[model samples]
Target: MATTDDSFNGLTEYCDECELDTLHEVSVQIRTESTKKENAQFSREPYRVSECQRCGHRTSQRMNNA
Candidate 1:
């Protein structure tokens, strides 16, 4: 399980209509060689993107993964 500290944290985007910063919750599922000791070729890594519900703004900020 990945913790919030394991993610990069930052503002996902700025809503021009609301004039407020939209916070995003982004998660990246990575498959590494170290993680696949049992099965090296069975890594299903994917990225997750979500926008702020309040502002309806979307952005894939790389900084919000801490």
Candidate 2:
């Protein structure tokens, strides 16, 4: 269960420990990345991080800012 005061975002995901689709706490984070070429330009990318409420299993994905 999520409380209004604590729940800013929530995501539905499958948890291996739970073995079901459960609600997860969601948050956005910025990660720095650079190419492995000679001119390696650094860039910050936004990622969506979700943590399972039951098992605390965490996963991250690059956010589609489209």
Candidate 3:
């Protein structure tokens, strides 16, 4: 399970419209992992859609819940 205190430090990517790399503000976040697994130690796959804080450019990415 992911923690609330998880760091957002290394989660940035390039924004084409902004013409620079900027931190994005998360617009939507969804967890796509099954909760009915036999083992309780399974990982999670989170889908996130964010917008560039500088130019309002939108992007989507899948995050590893390691």
Q: Which candidate achieves the best TM-score against the true structure? A: 2
lDDT string, candidate 3, 1-66, tens digits: 111223363245577898776666664475545667664345455677777767778877677645
TM-score of candidate 1 versus the correct structure, residues matched by position: 0.28
Residue range with the least summed lDDT across 10 consecutive positions in model 2: 1-10
Higher-ranked by lDDT: 1 or 2: 2
Clashing pairs in 3: none
Tell me the whole-model lDDT of each prediction, alpha carbons only: 0.48, 0.74, 0.61
Estimate TM-scores for all models.
0.28, 0.61, 0.41
User: Which of the two candidates, 2 or 3, achieves a greater TM-score against the reference?
Assistant: 2
**Candidate that would win on lDDT:** 2
Clashes of each: 9, 0, 0
Could you arrange the candidates by lDDT from highest to lowest? 2, 3, 1
Residue 30: error of model 2 in Å?
0.9
Q: TM-score of the candidate numbered 3?
A: 0.41
Q: By descending TM-score, how would the candidates be arranged?
A: 2, 3, 1
User: Which stretches of candidate 2 lie above 4 Å from their native place?
Assistant: 1-9, 35-42, 64-66
